[model samples]
Target: MAEAMPQTLLHEALQKHRAGDLVGAAPLYQQVLKLSPRHPDALHLLGFLLHQAGQSAEGLKLVNAAVATAPLHTDFRGNQARILLHLGREAEADKAFRAALIATPANPDALRDLAITRRDSGQVVAAAKLHARLLCLTPADPATLLAHSGNLIDLGRHDAASALLRKCLLLAPALIEAANSFAFLQITIRDLDLARDWFRRTLAAQPLYAAPHSGLAEVCFFENDLEACLRHSERALELTPDDPQIHVRHGFRLLAAGHVREGWQEFEWRLKRADRIRREGLPPRWQGEPLAGKRILVCAEEGVGDELLYASMIPDLIAAGASVVIECAPRLLSVFRRSFPGCAVHAYKREGDRFRPVHRYDWLPKDPPVDYAIDAGSLPSILRPDVASYAHQRPYLTADAERVAQMRDRLAALPPGPKLGFCWRSKEVAPFRNLYYTGLSDWRSLLTDPAIQVVSMQYGRGWREEIAAAQKAFGARLHVLEGVDMTDDFEDILALGVAVDAIVCPSTTLVWVGAGLGRPVMEFGVEPHFELMGTGKHPGFPTVRVFTRSLAQSWEAVTGAITDAVRTL
Candidate 1:
């Protein structure tokens, strides 16, 4: 009779729980537990009800108890994992989920949640495998297709992603995520006109959707419609104020539009992104204050060119009377040491977005231990808030004097004409970046010119063969630096940069270094960059003149303008 009473009470409790009568179901579940202490169903149901009532911690305890009682119960395990995930215990949740999958290998819900967890943790490849497995089980499920499309996109399988998105839309036409992903796919293919129209249609279907607004902002940006881009960006920000990426892009637009102060403020949000690895156990960031009798750490960021660009502010920190420590690329360690004698420079590697010093053991005399740390890119936000603030900062880098003289003598021994440094392509050649660079063949006029000797400042492998091929193709007068590894030895590269008569490149380390040294440089760009600060020129770098060509023009057509400028030099 007692056993039957507990079973009857459990049935009543489950009915009340399903009906959302938590207050009435609680006492019945308690009575079931009092009579039948090991009732896994009662325990799990009570835990779920508690979880529903916003008591995840208490619910997790009950769920774990239920799982202990019935180890093979799929519902108990799944509910336990849910409570663990809700309590932010990811590792435990993963274990619980794995157990659930083992018990019921074909469970669609378990597979979907595990795949999403992998994706959220930046494990796209793992997520893709799980999504593939899920799709096999539920091939006709539209939600699975939508999720699998995102994984395919992240894996760079654009065609497969597009097909899946099409299938998803066909199955569920009103699904906003499928529509948004498909629209974003058009942008990835660089079909801006098609993408813009698609985004507009999406916005029409759901007028208040923030994603389409963000998509339109990106389209407007690539098309050079800065005004329209900013408007869309602002609208996206208004709709989804907590989005970090949107704020980061809006910051770039603000800086490109000349709103310097507001731009820097928005740019600070980049640190809050998931990809930006948070630096734990570090001192607080240095706000613009007197750093007298204190020490600070400046983390290296971005590429070598960006490092040189941001190094402009390190000298200012020293001038304001603080001892500064910097972690930079191994290639720039020797050069940075020579340039900033007052600061300690160490080699570093990037972990996601932040720089980690190879050796903090060699930090400057620990009379005062490091008190604050700041990203190199963040320095300008504190030191140079406006255009006028950049004026007082002088040309801050110096190449080795002896090496510079030796390189000058070596170059003088060439053909007695103006020797120019050239970088025809960026290291990362993608659809978005291809517009900024031209092939060596496009440098036809300059390469064939007998009047000037163009030194190959181009880094990376196969460049030697490319130069050799170019020379063979046209009998051109291009020379490689005989003794220097141009890619890894920035000290030697800086010496060569200082020795050259002029530098002509799209955008690279040499351009930033040339600008820092006030050397004459001609920068060929296809669109606006934030560093130009909406002026189409470097405000602090007068000798670095910018040259632009409309996107409609062929890159080969723009080389003649470069040749013309070189002739005058």
Candidate 2:
């Protein structure tokens, strides 16, 4: 065998490799490679064998060489991508997987791995496409079916998701993955009882699983079972203490259930989340520290709604004599600057999940400079710890005085009836969030009432056609103000919300703007958010109230009730 020809040695190596004799295979692999340098098969297999032997770095180097030599070989590229993932080079791994799929589009392993990668990274749209292709290739795999169902759920194709989930469970009744997906599917469809049942079923199979407990907590919260909500939340944290999302969610659960002290403490865990925007070069987090003269950077997170919600505390910061630097969304820069006259507001651009500071104020100076950066969401934990800590929401955010006057004149021109501005839908109508919103169609009867004048405050791109359809169907036109790009004009939202007689809406930027303007805000949702602090009403904003439909009640009934409430106003 030592003097055997390269083909014979390679054949022997392959045979031993297939027989699980890596020790026997390694020498043959070496002989083949020694006889024939740059042999792709020998290099690939030897590298994989070393990787199996816990020598990943050397294995990756050899595999990289193989991929470089034969870039079009799907097998080589496939394993090379796996090694890239092992080294935690996810972006490179994803690109390599795409190249492998391009080479062999029907490659089951490539499809499965890449689809799983995309699914885990929150790229549901791309993952769903890959999952479809993979299911075509390997239709019977329970895991693929389970994963694809989740993507379907995220994409808001719940009926398709339900069908896939049912098929996945039918094929593998005791599969925990299928059980979990099935539970989430039920929750997405607003079947809380069924979701709770499936979650319990999943827990029966795997008692130590934290996710089912968290899911149960979510169901209990939506069902208004506050005790069970916090209990399951605690159990979830007990099972998986290190999961930041569970901690943050438990904070919401606790806060909503009236546990203020522990809630703020737990809510602070959001900063530890992997998905939180990176404020790498910014100042250290100001954890209730003394900031008499220090310049603090209070950066906004997620959206302008969040900024407006939390900016209610900036006055307190200024009162503490801190020189404040606020970073907000581009749309909010003007309003935030005007609202917080003392603070310098800079508009920053978001690059994926990282912050890219556009221009810095003098406070961003390097020498002994801004060493305290805090997320706007984090301020409540430090500043407003209890109920009385609120600054009493009497229009903390200010609109342009002239714009407000103009909006008032515009409203007066509509008719001699009560003007009710409303946002009927959230821009994100995904499964998890759709529970918080009743669609525009659900509010048709309410919006069509001729007594009150309806103004379309719904933002994002498609609201005009939707409002027009409402007008065409009922002949009661919802006044959409011209020149107000509701999506981009944050200041106009401030103006319009302020000038309106009342605001009736689901959660949106308009909620904060209206509530901040001290207007009557009749917020409708499946349940009151944790901001209500379990008190049925927002503590600071006296004019704001949450109207909700119980699990036993329908959305249409809730909308009808909201209509009656608005008519009285």
- The root-mean-square deviation over C-alpha atoms between each candidate and the true structure, in angstroms, is 3.8, 3.3
TM-scores of the models, in the given order?
Answer: 0.86, 0.90
Give candidate 1 regions above 4 Å deviation: 1-11, 70-75, 102-106, 151-160, 348-366, 400-418, 435-452, 460-488
Mark the regions of model 2 whose C-alpha exceeds 4 Å error after superposition: 1-32, 272-274, 353-368, 391-394, 439-450, 472-477, 556-561
- 194-248 per-residue lDDT for model 2 (tens digits): 9999999999999999999999998998888989898999999999999999999
User: lDDT (CA) for every model shown?
Assistant: 0.82, 0.82
lDDT of 1 by residue, 1-569 (tens): 87699899999988998898999999999999988787888888888889989999898888888999989888888888888888888778888878989999998888888888777666678789999999999998999999999888766687899999999888888888788888888876668778877788788889888999989987787677889989999999999999998898899888888888878888888877765645545677788768987789988765788889999888788888888998888888888888888888888644432222122334434666788888888887888788878887678788889888989888888886789988887766554466577778888889888888888788877778888888889876788878776778777777888999899888877788888777889888766577777887887888898887765556765688888888887
